[model samples]
Target: MLKMMTFFQGLPGQQSLLGTLDPGLSEAESEASMSEASSEDLIPPLEAGVTPDGEQEGTSKKKKSKGLANMLSVFIKGKKKKDQPRSSETEVKSKARPELEGPPPTVEELKAALERGRLEAARPVLALERELEAAAAAGGTSDEELVRLQSKVEALYVLLRDQVLGVLRRPLDAAPERLRQALAVVAEQELEDRRAAAGTRAAALVDTLWRGGVEEVAAERLGARPAGVPAGLSEAESRFLHMGRTMKADLEAVVERLKPLFPAEFNVVHTYAQSYHQLFAAHLDTLAQFELCERDTYLLLLWVQNLYPNDILNSPKLAQELQGIRLGSLLPPKQIKLLEATFLSNEVANVKLLMNRALELESQRWAQDVAPQRLNGYCHCELAIDIIQIISQGQTKAENITSDMGMQIKQLLLVELASMLRSYQHIFDEFLEKSKLLKNYRANIIANINNCLSFRTSMEQQWQIPQDSPSHLMDPLKELKAHGFDTLLQSLFLDLKLLFKKFTQTRWAAPVETLEEIIATVGSRLPEFSELQNCFREELMEAVHLHLVKEYIIRLCKRRLVLKTAEQQQQLAKHIEANAEAIQSFCTQNGSTATWLHPALPTLAEIIRLQDPSAIKIEVATYATWYPDFSKGHVNAILAIKGNLSNSDVKSIRNILDINTGVQEASRSLFSLIKVV
Candidate 1:
């Protein structure tokens, strides 16, 4: 107790008060009583003897006396009663309340609070940066201090850039709040950047953030130089293919994921599109410098001109999303033209080489006495099929570039194909004429005829060759068709010539043995007609039919023995009718759909068997209507067979049969293939 009295004696004015209050108690006990009293209850002294209003009311001695009088009064009163016990709750409040009501904070403390807000992401980091910039500009900040602040600001911006890019590069994982904060910072920096300069790119946040994001995505997806590419692909080919596929996928991600996160003013889709387009163009520009292989060249052209535009930029999802955005071409027109020119040059050279190679291989087979392979009884050769496919593929690839380019490629290939086919025909002609084993190669020649027909069809249908087009790609193919048929049928034609020679007066009076011989000869070979492709089989049968009709007509037109009597005319007409029946039956059975040619011989027999000159004239008129293509020369030839007709009668009959008038322009001419003396 006395020791506590000694502690109280140290307080101002407390020594005299404590001595007076307890003379019997020791001074130490009195001091201990005062010491136990709460120090927080004491009034705070004025700083440096200044009053609350900041006036120097008195000297330090006067302020200390005033504080001691207040402390002595409080201590005398407190010593009058024992100290009261405090509750735990009241003790905690007493300890905590003073700090809560403490004096105003310092400037450094305010700064520390702002920094904490920024670091903790509670405040916009860019706002703190802008405040720093404003402070530095306000003056009195030392260069060292400014540099330190600038470094800190730079670190914050860098972190901001990373966050923005992270949002772009991994949008699905980024938080919406973090993304909004990043965009707000970018927008704020953008406004500041625009206000500062007209055309400065240095330290531009928008470019830095957007371009960094796009480049990171491109590099990651496009991948480093492809090491082990797929089979048959060169390094460049593999790189371009990978680049195209990945760029498309990443841009789609940007459009679908990142674009909606940013505001419309940011133009996220267009911005990413342009960045990818420019980057891909740059890559292609580098590649175009080198001499790429054919595969790589085609692949590059495909990406630039076809896949990039059609499959990537204009893909259904991207196109719909980027309705107002105009991301333009992957490469500029001038560069694309250069690529096209290169591709065309390569294709032209390749087509010519392939055509020559096909011709050479075929010629080798001929030289080696290798019989052409037979497929299902039809002769087959790979030359025409191989050559056509090569040209077709080239044209198809060119078409993939563009429709106009496709036409250009087709024209080039058509010329090449025409030239090659001409050479092929020459080779075919040379082989057919010189080859000793002609019978063994007969089926092969027929197959080649079918090949020429296929070539013509492809040129017309696939390449869109017009009937009257100046290219005349059809001319050589037609010649090839004619040449093949002419060579194959030369022997059959010779047989027909000899049999028709038997149509003299004696054979007509007999059982028409010559007609039966002709029928047997053609019927034996009719099974071979099935070997030709269906479309051409009818054509071959028609050719045989026309040949037989023309030969028989030529024989009768010779007027070797005229039927002077009506009975003789009747007998001769019966023989002609029977002959017509046999020929028409053979042609129709052998797949000749030209039933139009079936009535020619029967109609001619009707004109011959008639006795009255007027009746004959009507019959000739009907015959001419059926065979509009029949000429006056043919009518005169038929009149020669009817020996009883006078010159006047023949003239009237000939007048009824006009060759030119009323003939449909599209009519097929059978007599045109025949000649009479």
Candidate 2:
């Protein structure tokens, strides 16, 4: 029974015993009965033919055990047969279970899982690195986690390195479009993160490099170079070159380390190089704030502009970073061209400082001299030309510089020339003031004016200043011409006014000789007048003509000769006619003042011919109507000239002239006459 129970429990199908043993008993009761029966029937069954007896009990027990063993073997054999079917059923379930399983992992899912792991591991390091950068930038000490994160990042990189490289090397062309895009995006993001880390490290290293007076250290290193090397590198230039090289090497190392981790299209080298350039540029900007000589500043700027690799400007990424830089301010475009030309020609010795020093000394010499000599335009031109010549000397060897660049240099020199012209303006003003007292005032003014004008002309001719030269450069010369020549001409006109006044007072009727003398003085200096000759001639002629007419009118009023005979009256008439003709001829030859002057002449002659008081009154009234500008004093003078007329008669004539026209008519007319004069 025990053997049967153990065999039944061990069989794959054991629950059948409960059904086989119970017909009316409860299931739990049947199971309990069956279990008890199996336990109590532990003794082996007696042999098939043996009887139970005390003496034979032991032998019977052995025989019963043998027969039970045989029955147990048969039951065991039946249980093995039943277990075979269960094993086959288990095999069927095992085979079907695989078909019920989910699908295989997709490429996107794999990439997502990969990125998750990378970001999970890298997030803490990225956060700690950002904190470290902020601390460094703020001049604070780093947190302890920074060191730990550094190692963690290194370890993470090692772990993800193969995966990252595999993604980078994956053949996207062979992959499905969506999967390829997913992989590419993941790879690019990873590369970007790696580049960011490298940049942060490089920036920290640059900060360390900049400390301890970078310029001083570079100068020491440069001095240690062989004696055969060119000497005299500026502090800023030496430091810039040294720092650039150091930053380049450091960035290159960072790139080399990261190169295998990114795709070929990532251009890691360009990324690091751009960062290096930006770092170097910032360092240069910091150095720029220090006090430096012009030459040293120029050399530093040149090193930034030309000595560095063209890649700095050519790379789109780096170019974007440098867009805000004003390279022209440090070294002007023309100066840059000149320096580049000098370098390309292998004539590395810069004499610009020496040339500027010489120019400054030469400019100072002008201040030491007296008035006119100090204002020497020729000296100004020569100094300017010397500067231009020095610039041009470099241009001769400048195969790299463009013609437009050469023109730009000349234009810049012209601007310098304009600035220097300001110092001489006061000298010209002084000369113009003192010139009023000179006997040869016109000649002195002409010489000075010609000196400046000719100098400008020659400069334009020599330098080939186009008509469209930049207005800033030409404005100075225009101002000089406008102010200096105009002031001088005004002074000459003032002198002419005095001379004409004297001529009117002393030789009123016979004034052609004095007028000729004035015209001859101006005409003799015509060559000096250059562009201003026409204006000077027109103004002088007008002045002389008006003065001559005014003097003739005054002389006619002042004459007090009574006509005692017909011959005297005839002579007076002829003299008046001749004066009128001379004025008319002069007016016709010069300008248009003769319209009123020619009419006045005949009226005055008509008055002289009329001898009777009543006839003279009628003649004077007619003349007054014809020439309304004739005043009461002019009528009185005419009447006084007739020696027969009394003061009362002169007064009566004035009253008649006034009543016939209007009250104060003669006074109003006199104002108009004065305006004409």
Candidate 3:
């Protein structure tokens, strides 16, 4: 029965009083008693001089007996009746705990220590925690409890963490200035990473999804909407239906973020500020064309149309839409605002600033390369037109916001157009110069076909000479004029054709009246002056002029003129109509209803008249008309050659260039113009 008391050390003061053991009790009985007693029992101690037979002890032994008696009594009681001393005498004899000191580690450090078997590092913390747990477990006095009140401490720690996370995410709700500072750091980080981070798919998706931060999140944020309202979902209900862990915020954002998300699909960032960079760099040979509405790039107006065929079919409506648009109606404020806010806000201040900047740059670019960057042919012109199309599309919906901006862009486009005109000017000067320097030894035979630049002139002479007689002047003139004039005309036609293809887009040609007027004016007047025919001083001048006007006027001029005699006019009209009918069989004028002007009309006419092929022999050197290049060299050499002439010498080697070429062949006013290296 006495041994039953030992196990109840759960009570206060229990372990100290239960130290003395009962010698008389058998080991089995003692252990069974210890095991049967609840862990919460208080055990009684044996008195120092007390016998197993319960004898009372002497005075000297009495003190020790009192200690033993106290221990024995404590061991006999269950833990429920136990009392621990305020300060244990054993604790007074125990050595004090060694001080622990180090740079404090976080919770993660303790976990790491537990994994690594670092009990020494953990002991200091474990001791402090154990002391606090023990004070609560022990029913300790007010002094012990006040020393470590953990419940209050844990509550404070939780409150602090919640407040911090809320402040970081919705910082404006707490402090606007912090958000601004954070945004500055974020922008700098993005710029630095813009190029280097292209291949990282994760970052690109982040950029796409996060275009609108708080504003979009707030707009999309679910609240406790009334359950029956259409499309309005309550926050808790949405959570319930979303299943698993996913929420509703991500689903609704799909459509609004297409463009922003597109780059991420490839995990690449294009450095271009605008789509125009695609023109030069995109693989055009393999390009799968999507023909979009020329006037509506912002909308879903694309179809599969190549540059030629579909263009030929719907060209009329396309031209009308492009040309007929009111400059003001092109751009609406809402679209301007949307594009700016959605795409252009970072780089452009507003549409006005954008247009102004473009104008300043375009003018600068034009002045630098106007001469070198000639609108060489249809290809060159199409590229320029494409750039215009992009500009037009962007500004089409930019009406009110684009006003001042549009004006600026218009000025730039005009300047670029002017640059193209200057390029044509250089080409034309090279043409006319060669025509001037051609010696009369070149038979100045005029072709009836002013239209076919490839045509040769035939000369018919009425000479009162015997069959054996030779006319030297007639022979040389006929030979030279037929070959030389044909070459010069071809070179001139090439230059004019280039300009025609470049400046005269179908968009501007619809009125027909304006194009006709342009032809008349360009044929008659030299640039920098209003005079109709003063710049030229040669037969070549008449040929160049006729060639320019004939494209527009051939059908008009080939018919009978009111100034000619009735019989002569009637004959001319008959031949002209027949030639025109033949012309329609091969070539097509680029207009609606698609007219074809014939390819062989002029050739057939020449062959009809020149019955003898031996009359003129065409040489390999004559194929290029070498007229343009030769003219440039001849003029530059002439001003320097200074009458020192010989047959084999360059000065006397009648270059074909002098035939259609001119002096001072420059596209500009010979002033300052900067160029990009």
> lDDT winner among the candidates?
1
Error of 2 at 609 (Å): 19
Work out the TM-score per prediction: 0.69, 0.31, 0.19
Q: What number of backbone clashes does candidate 2 have, counting pairs of residues 3 or more apart or in separate chains?
A: 0
- Compared with the true structure, the alpha-carbon lDDT of candidate 1 equals 0.64
lDDT of 3 by residue, 442-509 (tens): 11212111211111111112112232334332332233333445554564466556444422244222
Candidate 2, residues 1-677, lDDT tens digits: the string is 11122211322344433233233433344323322332112112333333432112366555543343333223222333321322222222222111212443322333244455343322332232233232222221222222222222222232333343333332221234433343454443334333433333332322232222233333343334333323676555556656655554444443444444435544444544444454555555566556655455455545556445443343443445345543333334565555544443332233354355644664344333312222332112344445455555644433223445345445444545555555444454565565455554444444444345544554667667654577655665555555655654564556565655643366344455655665555445434444333333344444444545665555556553455565566566776676667656755565444354456666777776676667777877777775676767677666555565667777877776665564334422321544221
Order of the predicted models by TM-score, top scorer first: 1, 2, 3
Best by TM-score: 1
- Candidate structures ordered by lDDT, highest first: 1, 2, 3
Between which residue pairs do clashes occur in model 2?
A: none
Model 3 poorest ten-residue lDDT run: 448-457
Give the better candidate number (1 or 3) by lDDT: 1
Cα lDDT of model 1 by residue, 147-166, tens digit:
33333333334344444555
